[model samples]
Target chain A: MTDLVKESSTQILAREMALTEQSVERRRRIVGLEPDDLARIAGIREVVLAQVDHFASVFFDYLSGIEEGRVLTNNRALTERARELKRSHLIAMVGGDYGRAYAEQRLELAVLYGRVGLELRVFIAAFHRLLRSIGEAVMKSTPQAPLEAFASFMALKKIAFFDIGVIVDAVVFERERVIRQQQDAIRELSTPVLQVRARLLLLPIIGVIDTHRARLITDSLLKAIRANRAKVVVMDVTGVATIDSKVANHLMQTVTAAKLMGASVIVTGLSAEVAQSLVALGIDLTTLNTIGDLQGGMDEAERALGYRVVSMDPRRDGAPLSPG
Target chain B: MPVPVLKQGSVLIASIQAALSDRDLVELRDDLADRVGRHRSRGVVIDVTALDVLDSFATRTIRSIAYTAKLRGAETVVVGIQPEVAFAMVQLGLSLDGIETALDLEEGMALLQAREAERVG
Candidate 1:
């Protein structure tokens, strides 16, 4: 379900994020990567290809040694799948085509790792150990020329950093998306419009009211008023921590809209601090029909709706019943 | 299409059927004003229940219709201004301030009757 909603594959995800060829070029420039670096990465392709299996085993060994990493590598099927993916990723690092395709591949892997609950820190630690082993193998292979091997290692390091940068971005992007979805859920949950009587509604607003939430509140309240044919609305804002001028203005607009729909809105339970701030902010309060508390607001709404609360017991009237 | 104005004794009730263009709105306003004068309606109720959007132009035209009818000795009560339409109007800073409003056709008639009673008594 998440995969469908979040864009299942790298192609769609890349397009959505605008990770085009031009953007990839821009990122390479930002990382100070040169044509020589690409050539060097490709040059070490054969050597790394031969040792990729060794690097994968070393990577798995490092992961199995760590407590947090064991949780991921314990499953035999998952370990075999991850080992194959890791081998391809190492080979791709030296494959030299560092464009949108390369970035998408790396992004796909990052997302996969993320789904399996691999923390970026753990992935980084294990990957770093593998890279070190590869660097040592390269230096040992080119024993005659220390400078050549060091150059290759440094070039590879730059690309590794670039890869890590993209992975970190992917992680942050996923987290932010989750936060936005959660915020939407909270916004929907926060403002509840309840029908109190035949022709009355009570909307208790609680939490921080951003512009989006304020708009939502107005939309839903209006719909509720229509649905219930509510003649009066008592909006209680005591649970709201603060009211800025913008929210105050939105409340006024909501009141005006309700009035236009033939419903009177009685704003109730404005905290002392919020009321004081509104006064201090010089917001126009004269148009707002504000009451001290929910009880008073309901009473006022009942009165406007012509709902007389009479005690069913005749004795409660404090007068003797007249006999025929 | 022309808005049909049904005369309910001393009151004129124009139930808007669908979204109206600017031209349609002007026609409705003029039609209501002419009918109110001819019928000598003591009250007029414009039911906007069907309107999904009440923009500034529509709001202004409705207000003008009410004022014109009022000058002809007819009190106008706008009825069934759908909640969404009303919210949109306020967001646009438009208001039907001088005219009275009622929840639906029934309430509009009740309000008109009460006013008539108050005037006679």
Candidate 2:
């Protein structure tokens, strides 16, 4: 789930957006951000530029009014930074250079917004208030040409829609990145090849086994066998809820691979339900050296490793202890 | 490079110190079979701790070497297949079945000795 270190954040963003110069142009076309629309927005740039501070204050005020939005705007320092970001973003919107760099900058801003726990809908709702104030500013500035002021607002809305699309995508991408990292963490934690004793390894598999996790389990088990010089492995699958053909095949492959590396694997904790399913599924269990449970598997492993567990208390066993 | 084969008592130890080409592997196999007969060795241990990748050709060659040694009355054990290499082998559907294997050279020696004792008993 972790990408290679060589990939830059910009490159990751590009991949996430599936973006190219042509695709960026395509997005502009889809959002109706044509050259005429850009011209109109640029025509009213001075009017909107003068009212940017007003727009930022209006947007921040709307954000501060909501419960979720207050989580971000409540911090004075964060609100100040967000105000600066808002001014620059608004200035760039009327600047009318809707290219790759513009998309990249907007996405970076959206990432910041995401990091501050700002939901897209909250930002969108607050953004509508700022746009409405800007619309009023346009109408008042162009008092003589009422129709042209309305046209400018329509042109501005198209670019705003384009920016919103980019922000929405960036937020989704950030969430996906978080999910991928969490999955990597879970996969690492799920398959633990623990060395239970000298020359003995215990692999307790829990939960469902997907192909990726199964690969990880086998990889770690083999590495532990080599690292610990383990002679026997007791794999307990009590927490594994099902035994499909694919899972059974993965288990068999793991056992065979361990055998090839001089470590014998004793599978344990095949629940009766799963066992019956395996039988019904016609999975050949002969290749698997299975025991009933973890205890039996450990006993068999101890015997294979030439280890005898002698009871220290004399009263616990009927047999007499041998003199050392 | 040609792998060096050392004889310890009736056992031959061949440690592969570098990535071997196909020619080097075949030569090592021939050298081991010859040395086993010349030294009258009863067991052979091929140490592959240095090899990082064991492709299908290498795996097949190793299996072939074990079978050839077995036919000549010397049991062969492959030792020190690295963890990553073993994982790759499994992913590539390569295996060394019917050939004895051990984690390291010492373990390989123990395995060969145990088999020898079993035969004697």
Task: Find the candidate with the highest TM-score and give its number.
Answer: 1
Residue A93, model 1, lDDT? 87
lDDT of 1 by residue, A81-164 (tens): 678878888888888778888888777667767767778899899989999999998888889998988888888887788788
Consecutive 10-residue window with the lowest summed lDDT within model 2 chain B: B82-91
* Model 1: pairs clashing at backbone N, Cα or C within 3 Å: none
Identify the runs in model 1 with alpha carbons over 4 angstroms from their true place: A1-23, A137-151, A172-195, A203-229, A235-254, A267-287, A290-296, A308-324, B1-88, B97-99, B104-121
lDDT of 1 by residue, B1-121 (tens): 7788899999999999988899999999989889888988999999998888888888899999999998999999999987677877887889898789988999889889989998999
lDDT of 2: 0.86
How far residue A237's Cα lies from its native spot in candidate 2, in Å, is 8.1
Deviation in Å, model 1, residue A104 alpha carbon: 3.3
Off by over 4 Å in 2: A1-32, A43-57, A76-81, A100-116, A132-152, A169-198, A202-229, A235-257, A267-296, A306-324, B1-92, B102-121
Local accuracy of candidate 2 as per-residue lDDT tens digits, A254-288: 88788878898899999999999998988888877
Task: For candidate 1, give the lDDT of residue A173.
Answer: 75
Candidate models: Cα lDDT each: 0.84, 0.86
